[model samples]
Target: MAVSAEDFDHRCEPCLVIDQQIEAHGFCVDCQEYLCKNCFSYHQRIKATKHHHLVNKDNMAKHAVIKESDECTEKCQVHKKEVIKFFCPKHEALGCKDCIVLDHRACDIDYIPDKCTGIGDSAEFREVLRELDQKVNEVEDIIKLAACRENELDSCHDRLIKEITMFRKEINDRLDQLQKQIQTDVDRKKFTDKQAVKNVVETCTNISSDIKQRQSRLQDYKASQQNGQLYIILKQAKSKLKSEEIKEADRSLEKTNMQYTFEQNQDLEDMLSRQNAFGKLALSSSL
Candidate 1:
């Protein structure tokens, strides 16, 4: 079988304990040795050596340089005696002649280096790099916008707190004014009621003094045995007792107890409970 250039590119380093014809499937960094698949599997399965790190043969191509000056000696993994000679583009794989005949007979095949040549200068390659740069810029913009939004969120929070505090203070100040007005009304009513009671007491005191004076005069009149004077004094006392001022004062003092009560405004309480002053925050649909 004719060995392809891809074989040279993927050629594994020679195993220490095996013939050069056997290709390595893995490389152990600790032991610094190339291993066939069977040996690599055995090394990992062993409890004593399982912890050691290993790199796959395919991945080692980038780090390991296979010189073109050296003879092609690496064998295929499937056909152990045959070397890889062609790359299948449809399958995106490297294979020996037997592998191509068995699994990729209908697939388009090409020389690896020839297919890959001038790829760096291709428009598709440049477009890919351009898209990557654009994606990076977009990510950067997103990060910057997010950072700005974070600051805005903090600022908005502080502003809302300040507004709420000011609003609360205004409510408190209004409440204080309301309290003072209610207190003033209470004081005014108290003064008016007290003055009414004072006036009633003064009128009753005057009536009591007049009745005592009339009683004294009648006693003197009776002692002198003057029936006319006694009759006149009794008549005057009866007339004074029936006076309008005395009758009105009696009725005024009967209903003199001033009563008052305070109750909370349900509408105001409901509004406070529902709205709570500090509004709600919501995400925009655009975001």
Candidate 2:
């Protein structure tokens, strides 16, 4: 019966390309290919691939993935066309043939395949893989924390804006109320001052009219040549003009200096000039 490909989990990459359907026992690290028992023995025996590093199938459970195309794709940075074949342990660097000859000639370099022999099964390699996994988990946690912080920041920003807007509205409303009150006070003061001035003017006009009437009366008496009547009229006019009521009116007019003026609230002005007039924003490092 023909063997179905489903029977093997890790099929030999070299055999899979040729439709051989062979099971792989080992994975070649340098060549990036899987080999059967016979192929693995042959690979080691071959002079070209004698120093090639390989990993057992069981050891490569997490390392190897079977593919149809299998070949070393790593190329040198300096020599683009040449594949990397040597490793410098001192610098932990990889280079091609010309690169090794020119730069790493003084250093004791090793064949990449030989240097990587049984690397997958090494304690250091396993520890490094575990460390990488831990580091990745840490990065994911940090990212999650950053996302939460970003969301919190957005919320805080919105809340603060609303508070500021509401506070400003409140301040404006209070200012409006204060303005109305001050306007009412100003109007009352103006009315009171104007009424006082009008009273003074009325009093002065009445006194002047009375004096004029008295003078006209005296003129008539003089024209009649009536000495007694003229003398009596003159005496009455003099006494009335020098009365206490007239003297009080003159004193009131002199004392009354009605001038409207406004003084700003210094406390309010100082509060506005301060940096944290509305409120202060406090920040803490601890979450």
Candidate 3:
């Protein structure tokens, strides 16, 4: 209860109204009256005025006036219109009559006004307040940790994506180099094989022309009855036919069948077949 400043001769208002002069010792804000010591004592005893704000004359000028509604009218959270009047010891909660009937029927309850006596200065109350503050701080720490972890998650995701992209780029660059090298090899092989086939064709044509010339000479010799010259030509032609150079040419033409094939890396193929993800995700609290 607080009192406000107002012009006064410091006389009891109730006494002055009855044409009696008495010094005021206190002021009742709700009644707007000044009272002597006796009247102040009676004011404290009476139930109606007991709850009213009262300030002694010694402290009246030090405080502002208290409003009528300044007294706490704490209402039930569940039943908003009903004042909280009961305390449940087991649940450590305040409730209205309806709450007691609905939820706290089996619990031993006490009238809140009676239960509140000396509670404001109790050691248990202070301890409860300390525990509440500690719990609140712990929850705040957990919230901060959650925020940090969320940011870290995003950072890790971005880093993994960049790594995967770099790995893919490296593989693509290597494959491109391999493709160019293989294509160059194929071209060089085609050139060399083409030259070998041309040489074989030229050798076969020269041999056939020599044989045809020999055959024409033999026919002329036979017509002129030159049997000795014919015999020498036949022997020379037979030796040339069985020569190692001619046999080697025949083998070279057969060996000239060129074919090429390419195979993928087995490890790379197995990785593509078996792997579904780039890497596994692991969660650790201690990091």
Candidate 4:
């Protein structure tokens, strides 16, 4: 069938180009469609950009519906809930399982259990933060340096370009004025005059060629130096800081749950039993 823009538009709603419906599933989590792709607006970005309306197949088991895996460390603090990871209070460093095992072999070790773990006692957390701060500062430093370099390079480039332009203009002017004078010569001194003009042209041409080369080099250098390399380095620094943020949050955490002393059930069984007896007596007495 010959297709046109008309096939894609209808009424106030966007038209469905295809009529096929998902008979099995009522929705597509990806497509967000009761029908086919043609029937749905391609909602590309959402808060959860990955979520889509998808229809379930007829034979799909309700019990077999898969839930998204919790890929993030939501509840567990010691990344993957490994065990009693220890941090050296003296050195203020992170200790992996192997590190803790080897280092605490003889010395007094302070193991931070996953439970009852606190930032107050977490040197590793503090260390990671310190490391992040250091990296961010380093990036900031490089950016500052790059900015200074860019300014200096740009100034040098501009001066060279200006010099080349001035030289090129002077050479062109001399060549043009000399050529015009020769062309307009009226006297019979043509032979001598032509030779003199030729020499002058050669000299000016050589100077112009040299200036062109200098201009090209200066342009190349300026372009390389002008792209805000300093700014990009600043961005890289921020990106590194964010990465460390993820690293710091990775496995070290202490989540505290407030506990109340109404924590246990008192002896309410007798009271409940009496209430139940009273209700039964009322029912019987009414009858």
Candidate 5:
């Protein structure tokens, strides 16, 4: 009969140390080493390693291939010579039998491999991934909202500048109108004063001409011995010289003097000063 690959026994790893070619009959799960029948008997008989878990070679071949270092062959940190095979759920720790009996006596305990069965496909793993995705979406939403707020701030700033420019133009326009109105009033007053002064000069010239004519008439009368006409002329001249019309005209001119000035508006000044802080930004805690 031809030998089959499946029926062929693997060489024992420990037997190779003595250059012996013993066939492996089992695998030590804790020690992660192949064992022959003789070595398996010796492994079971040992006091320290007697409780170490073992699996038949046929059963071990059906499981996933495991690296020796990645296996449960790790020695317990507290119990140096013991392998860690049990997990304590209550304390959330892994340890050897001695460590579990000493520190986690009353804790819920189980084999580490048994608890790890189908963990990758478990619902809790999916739920954790879902929660992480939700957190990422929330962070993205916050970033989008912040970008919108930045745009709003920029728009508000531009609008404020536009409003300021508009108000400034309005103020300048109003000031121009007021200045024009004041100039118009000044021009009218000037024209009226000039006309009044011209009238005064015309009246004075007419009075002087009348006085000269009366003096000439008096001389003619004196030459002809007309004393009565000369006396009448002197009485008219005295009344005309005592009139108060010229004094009244000088007082009216003095009253036409106008003074223009601007008064400050404290409220408007305060409002303008506060323009330094046009807008304020605040964050919402709801995020």
Candidate 6:
């Protein structure tokens, strides 16, 4: 655990430790040695130490803390610096003054990123988006793969159905001849034949049910894809609206518009009449 200055205070040289009067800065840069302004040299020269270094100045304190500087969380692949707090009004990222001087000259620097990102840039929000987008993409890709599966099922089922129909027709013609040869009083032992017919009907029904289920899932997958797109837009909108300062800033931001107008309702009528327009569907009995 890191001890406070008070906990370590006067433990060494009492005279070396300065109060607020001298403006005490913490720790050294070149060396990890801790000292107030006065005792640093004496602390350095004590043993095998020939040259002692110290950090007392404001600039030195700032430099020493670089390793201790809190990591920046905001990501803009274009910018290397962590988004500290200040957002560049004209640019697309949050940055510091050093960034402002170089790349963000046209931007209005707002509050530090640390203070404003409590809700939007939190770990929970990031994790949620990452998981949601990943799952949505994965499901959509599976649905596309299912198209090939559906085609295979259709081809396999059609061939088997044709074969079944031909076999049944031959079996029925043989049964008719067998019945004519038998005596009228004969109690035909047809338990096996009845069972075979029942089995065939069941097999066909089961396959038809499988096809229906796949069709339903394909429809649901498409619906989910559409919903996923809208959900993404809504999430972005919610995040934008959540930050008060961002919303306020954007309200006044100038927007450039490009406009074109249609002459009549002809386009709307054409869309309504077109069978495939906007994914309108008409299904056949075979389907």
lDDT by residue (63-110, candidate 2, tens digit) is 655442323469888989978767788888888767767777778877
User: What's the candidate order when arranged by decreasing TM-score?
Assistant: 2, 1, 3, 5, 4, 6
The TM-score leader among the candidates is 2
Candidate 4 lDDT tens digits, 180-273: 7755653334445555556555655665675565556556656677546545554554554455433332222211122223222234446545
Q: In model 3, what are the clashing residue pairs, if there are any?
A: none
Name the candidate, 3 or 6, with the larger lDDT value.
3
Give the C-alpha miss distance for residue 127 in model 5, angstroms. Answer: 3.4
Query: lDDT of each structure?
Result: 0.73, 0.80, 0.77, 0.47, 0.74, 0.53
Q: Lowest lDDT 10-mer window, candidate 3?
A: 63-72
Q: What global local distance difference test value does model 6 have? A: 0.53
TM-score of each: 0.52, 0.59, 0.50, 0.26, 0.45, 0.23
The residue ranges of model 4 lying beyond 4 angstroms of the native Cα positions read 1-116, 184-287
Model 3 C-alpha lDDT per residue in residues 51-158, reported as the tens digit of each score: 988998887655535444433378889989977767788998888767877788778877654445577789999999999999999999999999998998899889
* Whole-structure CA lDDT of model 4: 0.47
Best by lDDT: 2
Consecutive 10-residue window with the lowest summed lDDT within model 2: 63-72
TM-score of candidate 4 against the unseen true structure: 0.26
So what's the TM-score on candidate 5? 0.45
Say which prediction, candidate 3 or candidate 5, comes out ahead on lDDT.
3
Across residues 154-222, which tens digit of lDDT does each residue of candidate 5 receive?
Answer: 997798688888877988898789779887987887788778767767766776788788778878878
Per-residue C-alpha lDDT of model 6 across residues 1-287, encoded as one tens digit per residue = 86565654222222321122222444444444345555565556667543645555445545544333334456544455534435665666655444555675555555442234354768878999999999999999999989977997799779767877887788679867866655332323244444545655565566567556655655675677866755655555456446554333333232212233335357767876897653423444553
TM-score of 6: 0.23
